[model samples]
Target: MRYMAAIVLAAALLSGCQGADKAGVNGSSPSSQPEVSPTAMSATPSAPASSSMEEPLLYIEQLRIIGGGQLVQVKSNIDIDQKSLEQALKNSLQTSDPETEFRYTLEWESPRFVQIRLHLDENSVWSGTFNLDEAVTVDGRKYASTEQPYRNTVVIRAGDGEGSLLFQGVTSGTRRVVPAWNTGWIKPVQTRESVAPSYLFYGQEKHHLVHALTGEALEIPVFAQEKDAYGNDYGYHEMYSDRFYEDFTYMISGNKTLYRVDLKGFTSKKLHVFNKPVYGMSSSPDSKRIAVLTAHDEFIGPGADLTVLDQQGKILHSRENAAFISHSDGFLFVYSLAWEDDSHLILPADRDEHNPLGQIRYNTGNGASSVMQDERITDPLKQDLKEHERQPHNDLLLSGLKWSPDNRFAAFKSGTGAIQVYDTQERTFTFVSAGTLLGWMPDGTLAWADIKDLVYTF
Candidate 1:
């Protein structure tokens, strides 16, 4: 699955252009000129962005702050070539016109590692690992990462004490304005052997298949556990999508009896069990109601298929077939819920008529609903733009979509570990997080996780 994701990512990065377009980065005014050529140019899509400024950025590599500096770490299956680094370091080094000092920047030459910020110095020739956070140690005294340049030298040169000295660039005091991740996942006492390992909630739980280094793959249920119960604890339950509520999401649980969590119920009383024990669990868009698959029909007569209960664990509106449910009543197989409009609820489910397995919006009012997102269901939608949904994908077969914090779109991982996002309203798609299994918030915003052994956030 990881390999598949890597391939998909590679193809996506090098696909040229789908139909006919210019080869530009999100069409940022052609580098050169469009020219008098008749053929249209293909362009690279711009990097993904969210409306919220606080969203944590998702990087293909790890990001961190260490050595009192903002440094980036790189990893590679191949061996690190010190000779190559020396050559690169030699080329990266540069001095001012006056030739008072040297300034060479050495960007780490690895691919699989992460990015973190570390030390700074006079002239602060920002290292490849320098950015956002940079520490300064004048006279051998370690100081904060924020330090100014002096002596016309733009770098510290990582004296003999330093293991490796890379080239450098200009130093900066401005730190990146990224959201702070949750820290609860690690706070709890956990061990390496803990089951139901805690998780991070960058956005919310989403289903893109997961793969291990051993080449084993499975559509595992994974997500960031929780961070201060953000978004009314929805991050622990839902995913994002373009169509307000129509999206794919779900929870992995053996206990199918419990439906809605009552606010008044507190910890113990908060647990609300459904009258009908079934396979799926869903929540209402309003966060006021809950819906569960009633057992009355599956094996018996005209089954009272769905049960609707209020936040207080009281029955509100019980319908025969809750094919149409409100935010108060989430959908089956969907760990999350969204709102298409005041009258409709967007849920991720498998519909026969629209066999294409994208997100389907059900009109709870008059049962008059349309397809909110069919494109995600690669195979099911058959790529029929004429139809309300999109044809599902093949290599990447993942489900259980979730909305992000900003409530803009939905995201999920495919069987191959490729992560995709579907606009709720525009019905278009934009790639967000991509890996063996895109866990945490589907939107890719950073959140914290408590996996028993460690509590980390991204």
Candidate 2:
């Protein structure tokens, strides 16, 4: 059971010096300030000062800025050797606009890990943690140190902010070099209501009809009373097979019984029932037919049967072991079992040597199955793999491919934990915040949920 509530949009503003001491800035000045070195800072952690020196040098490890339609990872090395750490940071970090200034707060989690909250303004703030012990590389340039005596490497985690920052780094045999900002990476767009759409979602208490454009949600009492094998009112539960039939009507399954519900009047009628448990359901584009995927037995294991039914609950076609069930993280569910048209259904087939996980196009008219050859589905998967290879870490495989209602956009989880949306029309990709890709709204806006908030985006 998934628990969710209304979205909470809060701007986190961290203030004051809470963990600045952990950064090795103890307000006590060095016995003697060494002459500023003209040599470029080394990418590795600075060597520890000798017993004659009073303080160790500080270095900027990793700095990332997310805003202004761009995600920037600064590929430069900065060394600070001033008497005051506060004055050194203030002089080093600056925004694009000279008129606007910024403030920051640091909270030390461990000796080397510190959480930084940078506030550019009341509306724009970013908070992320930096681990000084790890080394991260963007493109070909690297920042921070691999191990201790702990270099002053600052890696800012992704946070909510708007605007850009400009900072200079040191290069060998030079006075000071301001490296060019790498803007080649994908930019994260702001969440806007203009591109959002209306949709329905199952909440912790009941069903919610959400209007994304206006940010309004209406509660709809539609949860069926679930019962155990002994026939007691176990609790209220929403099944995975529950889906919308057009905009106002919904088809949901409880136990082995199916119900057709009208949202406007809150009325429900019996549709159909299967001998076993219902695994998944999808309504046709025309809403004239429904395709249901059911488990073969109560155990609900690997294989499932497919049943196509008309709006009148009459079975148009039925096949045993027509769809294959895949398990992930201990959850048993069928893959995409959607209707390509009123007469054809696209469903997963059993695994084979040639096609380990494949799908087939099942024709309801002739009861024939054929290999699915739609490039609209296959091309984006190939693109995800290609995109994954370009990432710094390629071990994280892409999963959870979800297409929009109009089939204009496809979304999936990328290797970096961010949700990457592929625009099939433009043949481009955009990165969004990390979350689970919920179903798309009627107007094609994508909905997703992180641990705390439910975000709607396009």
Candidate 3:
């Protein structure tokens, strides 16, 4: 229930960090966040670093937040003793400890490169360059580019000792994201042949080898890969059809589910096979249950059958052909799970023959179904969405939804790029335009990604 509230705090707490130049939010918590104008923010710098004396906390580690083509800002320890590292961050994050003179190392990720940051204390702004040595070797060559000089000059402010490392890049920039700890982050994609879309990163949190792109399916860490309650490996452990692509188009049921996987060393038992072909599906938030749509059929339109199951693959309940016999709104059937709630499922219905408009929603735990939005308006936004790209969501797929860890919110963008919150609980709308953005901050404030020049929109 407090899912939305948590993000609000995160956004506000970090808004004063370097990249939040357009934000004017300031508050200790979300409920009291105050609004500031663009003009007001332009007049000041991020809040001067704080001076807490306790051991610095790490807010971000491992993963870097990539936006457009560059790293925005590293989110790290939001609360830190600002006085500890004043001189060490002059060049990089690694520095000799002021008191013990011991080694301190840190790493960073970007859209195009990987870097290491070293700091000795909390206060020092970066020195003129990235390192003290005159030159560094690359590929056994003492290469130096005058145009792209090595910059060790790093800066830090209050509570940023544990910040997430951010890098510089543009969305279309030619630079590529290189991996640092080869074993920790990236791994050889098991597909054998790599081209066009080549490479896989161990999604530590999701427990899969997720493709960086929007469309491909990543391998789920199952059985044999499960090393422990924690420390599991995510790689090709068993024999799965290399020729088949996981086009998981439906969210019928389960916290997480796959019809089948072949893991090695670890044994598994088959619970239930589909009575028919599997189609769309959704799973509960707890990951204990599952719901799936049956195989596709070419009627006047596409129709589906719904199936429910448990983690052990045991059939709980089955519903066949539960969807309408229309495909005009093909996008509505994009997924069967609500974004916000794991306890619900979305079923698509034809708005009309052309499939331009469709109805979609989920069956909540209350034994009641909720319509995402009535079929009273047009789908409005349209573009060439490749089968894999899912963001810049369609309203039908997101409306009347719920979140598990409260990671995402149900918001809508109109033709003009204005986004409004469709609060599922209040059933009311709060609009944010180019003028204002309302998202959750680490400290529970209304935070948002403020865009300047509109080079692209989806």
Candidate 4:
């Protein structure tokens, strides 16, 4: 079934006499300027402008389109001819099927602008804008200007499918293209009281830690500056806890050593070192215990072990080959570790033919393992996976499924690079923009990096 797509165009009217006199076009005086036919202006009510003036300067102010369960709003200030505005709207609002019929209504938003609402029965819509100031007439067709600034700038490009906006630093030359859906302005919601302290590993060599909330940085004196076989530099790869300390955060270095860094003093203290490389780490909700996963090598395979350590790095429980299982492909890798509570560690097991994607519950108190049956945790994980599969494209990476400290929301990077937060209780997804998930602040706010800056959203 096709949904009705609604398009609303807002146009601002200026003094026609002044605009025409300034242009001095066709050797016509303001008094001799051609009048817009009543038929051309019949659909729209008379705009609130100077009735004494012979003409009114018209420019598209904003365009809002709603259809196919999506809404796109574009803001611009491009001049357009009144006689051709109706036909231009129709041409730009056309769907894939050329025969589709549509209608529009005009509403006066203010004395300066009028809103044109176009309604169509279609599944998708594509629209673009043109700067009519520099347009040229060719065979009765108006071609947009090819001038430098106007030609390079895209006033509006809206569609039902995925789109992105490229952002670049004015002088730094740093560039990032985020999903266009995230470009819409939204009022920040006050949903949390205190945010978890978040940090990001950023620098030319990624050997520096910057606080996500504050613009503070600390150089890791002992950070592993080595490179992998693939020429990828190794440093701090993940931030384990943002809720553990007020002035410190727990992070794992590339060399398999964990450290607690002071966010205020800008110092680092070695916490513990794993014998093998660390794949994943999770701190208990109480911040008293830490679960570390280590494997024989960096790549996923056999010989994966799980260790429960105290805050001082003393081992409380150890299990060999407990995190993964062997399969035809060599091993079913287990990662994305989190704690269901202070006593139970939850591991999302990799899917295999014999077993669907499931979770393993490791009891820290008894050192026993079993299939996770807690509906509270399993249900949310299952729902999150189901939503991930429903995304249009599946090839994109969907990683970093971290649960909120309260276990109410699960945040992950969707296929389109947008950080989607899934509410376990509400069973809904919130697009938090395109970036790397940098864990959550204690107050339920999410922290992420958009390659250019650290973004915090709730």
Native-to-model Cα distance after best TM-score fit, residue 162 in candidate 1, in Å = 28
Instruction: Report, for every candidate in turn, its global Cα lDDT versus the true structure.
Output: 0.30, 0.44, 0.31, 0.44
Per-model TM values vs. the true structure: 0.31, 0.53, 0.30, 0.42
Residue 358 local lDDT, model 1: 40
Worst 10 residues of 1 by lDDT: 162-171
**Tens digit of per-residue lDDT, candidate 3, span 93-120:** 3321122232223222221122222222
* lDDT (Cα, tens digit) per residue for candidate 4, span 49-113: 33433332333333332222211111113223333433444443322122434334433333233
Q: Count the clashes in each prediction.
A: 101, 3, 83, 4
> For candidate 2, lDDT tens digit of each residue in 1-458?
01112222112111221334433232222232122211112233333433322233233322222331111111112332222333434443422223344345543423323333344343332222222222322222223322322233232222232222211111111111111111111111112233344444444455555454454555667555644311212122434332343334535445456667766677777788677766567777567787887776556666778888888889988988888755533244334577777799878765443443366888988989887543455545566556533443222232245677666776776543445577766667664434434445445545544322223221
Q: What is the lDDT of candidate 3?
A: 0.31
Q: In terms of TM-score, which candidate is stronger, 1 or 3?
A: 1
State the weakest 10-residue window (summed lDDT) of model 4: 183-192
**Number of the top candidate by TM-score?**
2
Kindly report which residue stretches of model 4 are placed more than 4 angstroms away from their true locations once superposed: 1-201, 204-243, 296-303, 325-334, 352-358, 373-449, 452-458
> Distance (Å) between predicted and true CA of 33, model 1?
56
Task: For each candidate in turn, give its C-alpha RMSD to the true structure in angstroms.
Answer: 21.1, 13.8, 21.5, 17.4
* lDDT value, residue 89 of candidate 2: 44
